[model samples]
Target: MAAATPGLIGAARAQSARKTFVFVSGAFCGGWIWRPVSDRLEQGGHKVYAPSLTGLADRSHLLTKDINLDTHIADVVNLIKWESLENVCLVAWSYAGFVGSGALESVGDRVSSVVWLDAFVPTDGQRVADLAFEGFRKAIQMAADKGEAGVHGLAKIPPIVVAERDRAFAESKVTPHPVGTYLQPIKVSGALQKVAKKTYIRLPEFPQPHFDKALADCKGDKSWTTFELPDIGHMAMLDAPDRVSELILQAA
Candidate 1:
């Protein structure tokens, strides 16, 4: 069945002072995936920028083996620098924690806050791939061996994760992600701490073990706010754009 076009469940809240947002999408997706949430934010009187990574989304033409985690990080960092955005709220989804977190390293001061929407919150030098469940790793490697994935280890989307309503869009719009981006260890420059506020949203239905520690850590920190959306899945921005946008606005 085709999914109905999603929109805010209710009327938008009163417009708040405009805030700047830079959205980082998860692996395989380009900035295109951020349309729903960004649109809502923009309608609510905010500035939004969702940039595709070097080898994903509309940029799939640039796909090459040389692309790694750092390459993806540089993509967002450059956008902020080139645009000269200040007091920005950096929002990252799913696997983008690695890419987005590392991007903040150099320009952390420009960021007013960060909102990790079920994104991997990596410790320094941690690789996102290494944090996955063991069986998940084997399955990806098998896909690579069969050439179902790209030669450089770019992975095809697993069917199980895509909702039936979302399947058509996912197949048509999603692109292969650089395997190097997953395997490459993220280089953290301690710049994230320079940003004053942070929040981590947990989508319980998805059950990301890697984010378990992060959820706990954020809850304990007085400076950070944590939220849980039990009914939502990993792609909450698509499933619950209003709630996601609210959390983001609050974080900012």
Candidate 2:
């Protein structure tokens, strides 16, 4: 089926009942990346929580080779548990799809739905690095082998991947993601699949290493609602907040 247009998405969203949301950022980024979309969602009377993972964003001071996928999963899982959040819409972008899926094993019953936004959906025991192309996987592994990859083992966001206006800002904010997070095998209990609803949003305008396979999986699955945002990059929450919010609301 074709994706709903922004206008149609808006119409559907307007009638949606407010719900709680938790957004996990992609590699090398913090929860701050979801501010644009979260703000819009909140304005529509929803509760939103965008938590930074353990070793990235404002939490970079805790970076270590020991910060594996489980650590990242704990970060979000703990948030929901601590806040007593329920009936949630969990949104994971990029690598966090792996992290987020693992986290759901513990709290899937609390979640109302799951959304993979240009993210990789790993099967049980699959790692983010495993889902990626060999070359990209090698690049991340090489960085981890060196103690801290990229900038002190931080993978810098390529300037060209973003639009000209936001390139400078994105460059300043992106940090190196932990190599351990990528290398560690993501474990799932199949709990995420049991959520009442699930959606996958694809940003084909700007490609990523592992998302195409994920997109294909979501498209073929009769259980998932899939949408395509043409000409929007993987960071659609930043580049296309209004549209992203509507799609999310549509799914919610």
Candidate 3:
């Protein structure tokens, strides 16, 4: 006997109930970086949207000395509002985590959950620069000294620091990030306090002392989850797309 249409309709409804995944990439990256993960998600019968932040990838022209953390946050917040997205599962990578957190502050009710992919989690009043390691800061300074303009010294990223072969491959795929975004301090009030769920995807290669402290502070908060991807790097999606996709599905 043929199955009833009502049963099929019920299955469709269950699938449709899955929330959309919105990926906000870090500095120097764009939507293109998320292609692998997005493909996997789509294959899994889910919709994924990756928005390139200002001053990165194909949007390099948008980079200016004036564009700061607030500007980046507004970009994501506006996308969420303009698209009328509700219960969004936001995934942010690297520097985009700061941008994502600020956007969350702006649209707390709209975000169903947040996943930080080996990224920063700034306090209420902190700048991305504050989170940078001393070596990273020195690299920026050296790059600026080389006469690279627009605050971020985009042209100097290649030789400043040592990177593993895979990490370099991922980094080489993107354009320069804006200096303004790094310099500008983020302003996050009670936004994180209101978000229903938060998760952190820690990469083994990157040192986690700072993040570990942050997570410890929020431990037992009943709204946070932490997972470690020992085989991944800062750019887990690009370096290990399958594992990243699996983690994302698990988080969802």
Candidate 4:
């Protein structure tokens, strides 16, 4: 029984070591949106934390014009420091990519990998506003025209851009994100250039030829890898949780 005890202990240790803690940041979304994916990951013997940014989720009342991209970045950075989470797999979806990139700049060494899900990869001196679609710009402008103040004032999620079902879910769970976060320009330099690994999870339906070309250019450099989900839409996690979970696990 002594030898058998050692073998069982070793198996348990192996299982624990396989556990990867994931931090997911949603675009214009609260942590609640990650409930489904979090459930799947937890069931698979992993840990996941999805943080709701200020002015988002039940925290909508916290919305203010002063909340900018730096504020959101600081939120994630503080969470990592407070939790002392090392070797974390950070996943940024859509607009959260901007926030995630800032977080990466702050905690590059602590992150095991950075994954962008159908999101933007801003270059140096670029703002989230620079990446917005013309329609999105118009919508936000229209909202501002109505005399609504602050970032949360532009609370509109077009169904045509996101999957219909996911749009419904998002609409039900949606909260205002800070407009300042979108308006503030992100400043990147040599530090962010040194991140350990970067991966882009591309959604096939989004017609982003320039993004595809940029990602392709990075492929041969060994610092990046692009994974395409042909069957899924922009909201791959919601559209196909199983596959998204599987891919995340594999990446982990």
Candidate 5:
């Protein structure tokens, strides 16, 4: 039998050192959005958890007027605690940033790193509506007036950015996001800042004021390692999974 190669041994050692990752998806989306990136990390022998929030995507059936930011936060915290995961790299995208911030309050000690992917970083008592644009807040109000528990009709990503073949399926999977999640204020105890390693990946192609502010703030902060992917769209994981995976791994 041939002896094991040095390259193979080194690869094994690197894989063993990889940390677990918990990916929180953005609004109107779910765990499915992280598939492109998660698949790559899993292939590299890393544990990755990307659960759909309470009232989005596959879990849309659970939608209710009462599902708020706290509900989504519990979904993430319970997953980490129940699984007994440690050295986790908590990754949040877009609207899920609020969820990640709240979850960190309970499970911050278990997380070794955090990555905010074009996501809002809200301070204490800040709600998504506060950070969101006036247009978005109006949309949420309209959704409520229409007797809907969730909000829809927002697509920040241009059709051209997604692969032509995957466009239809991708559109079908985006369900109405719980309206309460946007309206409810998130209670943050600065747990997100306490993570040993923090990163922020900004996609400049899809411009939004909140995201612009987030990028600027992270760039100014000494603790955060920031990266700007000017070519990628809002959905970096799907638009450029390889690049997103590389960034996530670097954070870990």
Candidate 6:
């Protein structure tokens, strides 16, 4: 009988500990928003993907009135399928909660855990309009009336606190988010809740009744784990990447 060498044992341990993380960005933002946290996770020997949804950021050229919630869901579902990812840790931010939830309908079996980070958590047949504030609803309507594919300027007033140095860079990267994605009702089948690990993280420095309510609701659910990072704002990934990465790892 032979014992495993330290290097071989470490390699085996790393392989066992490795995880796949798919970060879904919020409205008016793109995969770039997940860079800080993704980098940290990748450094820890995990496979991390932060894809820009259709009609946003790098994909802004594809923006059109035709892109809807299903389009975004396919974007994620296909990513999982084509990437051949299994036992994934799905992380959704802001408006992506709905998108992620919808995606779970198709890829839930592939997902081991789901985390909603300062994001919406909708039930079946609920659209973003159903959960969004009046101001947000108005913004979507205004964009529709203007015959625009997306709603602009919403990112100008982020609920999250951006440091001065990162402010300009972050502002420059934001693109108009497709309005169709918001108007369409997400079709979920409790797929998200079915995942083995469910978590809700609230970044509460700013006042957002919707996220506050989400945190409270999840707290009442025995199946879901909840956390509050009150020191940071809504974009906790950027404001506190270390903490965000740590939480995702814990959930995984």
Mark the 10 consecutive residues where model 5 has the least summed lDDT: 156-165
Model 3 lDDT on a 0 to 1 scale? 0.74
**lDDT, residue 31, model 3:** 91
Candidate 3 is scored at a TM of 0.85
List per-candidate RMSD values in Å. Answer: 8.5, 7.0, 3.6, 2.9, 2.9, 1.4
TM-score order, best first, reads 6, 5, 2, 4, 1, 3
Q: Each prediction's TM-score against the native?
A: 0.85, 0.87, 0.85, 0.86, 0.92, 0.95
Q: Local error of candidate 2 at 4, Å? A: 36
The residue-by-residue lDDT of candidate 2 on 52-148, one tens digit each, is: 8987889988887788888889999899999999999999988888877888899988999888988888887887777766677788877877776
For candidate 6, what is the lDDT?
0.88
lDDT per residue, candidate 1, 28-132, as tens digits? Answer: 788887888899989877899999998887898898767888898899999999999998999998889888889888888899899988878888888876887
- Residue pairs with clashing backbones, model 1: none
Residue 47 CA displacement from its true place in model 5, Å: 0.6
Sum up the clashes in candidate 5: 0
Off by over 4 Å in 3: 1-3, 141-171, 218-220
Q: For residues 157-239, what per-residue lDDT tens digits would candidate 6 score against the true structure?
A: 55465655567778889898888988888777788889999999988876778888889999999999999887686777887
lDDT winner between candidates 4 and 5: 5
- How many residue pairs clash in each candidate at the backbone level? 0, 4, 0, 1, 0, 0
Query: Candidates' lDDT values, in order?
Result: 0.79, 0.81, 0.74, 0.71, 0.88, 0.88
> Which clashing pairs does model 3 show?
none
- Residue 156, candidate 1: Cα error in Å is 9.9
Model 6 reaches what TM-score against the true structure? Answer: 0.95
